[model samples]
Target: MRLILASTSPYRRELLARLDLPFETLSPQVDETAIPGEAPPETARRLAAAKAAAVARREPDAWVIGSDQVAELDGAALGKPGGREAAVGQLSAMSARAVRFATAVTLQRDEERFHALDSTLVRFRPLSLEEISRYVDAEKPFDCAGSFKSEGLGIALFDAIESRDPTALIGLPLIAVAGLLRKAGFALP
Candidate 1:
């Protein structure tokens, strides 16, 4: 079966590649905007489905995988920082706090659909302004929600990570992805 990833994120691309499956990627070009009343998990779900549908429209015969991640702190959704100061602030606000990352994925082909949601809780260690500054300057994770990359230097900022699927924290839940793909008749050993 043909496989396609409906995203341009290098992180997601790398995570998907771990399956050792030949796949192609297309820029979903999805607007990552949250609705005023939508819950963080819901927003992730909506966006993931939208991404898959967008690409599925172009290649109806291919199995399209779409995924989205949203970070939630104290009941509010946190978006990508987009810059240095914003990243620092985000980290500061999250210091010694447990942040929830909702990663949602959807697989679509013709009329068949499969979906998965994984919520990972990351407890951040107490951080000083200097440490936050140093980390931000070194990693520059402005493009990631919650301003930290779990797979890289950002892991130093976390006291604990609680999740059924560790890869979900990085942006794609491979466990869930594998299950959904298997359900769709894709072979994996």
Candidate 2:
């Protein structure tokens, strides 16, 4: 069976490559606006499933993988910064605070589906304005939800990280993905 990834994120694509699986990527053109009253985890799960289903509609025979991530701080969801100023602001606000990154993954083929949600708690070390500015300028993590990339220089900004799967922070949960693929009869080992 052909494997497809319903996303345009390079980070997720890179992670999936680690599994040594040959997968094609398609951009899932789904609206990502958060629904009112929807929790962070729910948002991630809903988007992930929507992405997979969108691609599954196009390629019904292929196994499609979709994933989404949301960074939550004080009950509010933080999306991609999109700019250096916004990234600096996000990092400043996240300074000395605990943010929960909820990453959800969905795999679908025909009428069958599998889902997994991984939550990672990242405690930001106390950051000064200069530090935030420098980091933002250096890494330019404008496309990342938390305004940082744990796999890169962003690790220096964290005080502690708590998660069952460390890859979740980078955007995909390989452990969960492996289990789901195994259930779907993929030779993961």
Best-matching candidate per lDDT: 2
Which residue pairs in model 2 clash with each other? none
Model 2 misses residue 67 by how many Å? 0.3
lDDT of 2 at 144: 100
Query: TM per model?
Result: 0.98, 0.99
Lowest summed lDDT across 10 adjacent residues in model 2 is found at 131-140
State each candidate's clash count. 0, 0
Candidates in order have lDDT scores of 0.95, 0.96
Query: Can you tell me which runs of candidate 1 are displaced by over 4 Å?
Result: none
Which lDDT tens digits does candidate 2 get at residues 1-189?
799999999999999999999999999999999999899999999999999999999999999999999999999999999999899999999999999999999999988999999999999999999999989999999999999989999999999999999999999999999999999989988
On the 0 to 100 scale, the lDDT of residue 63 in model 1 is 98
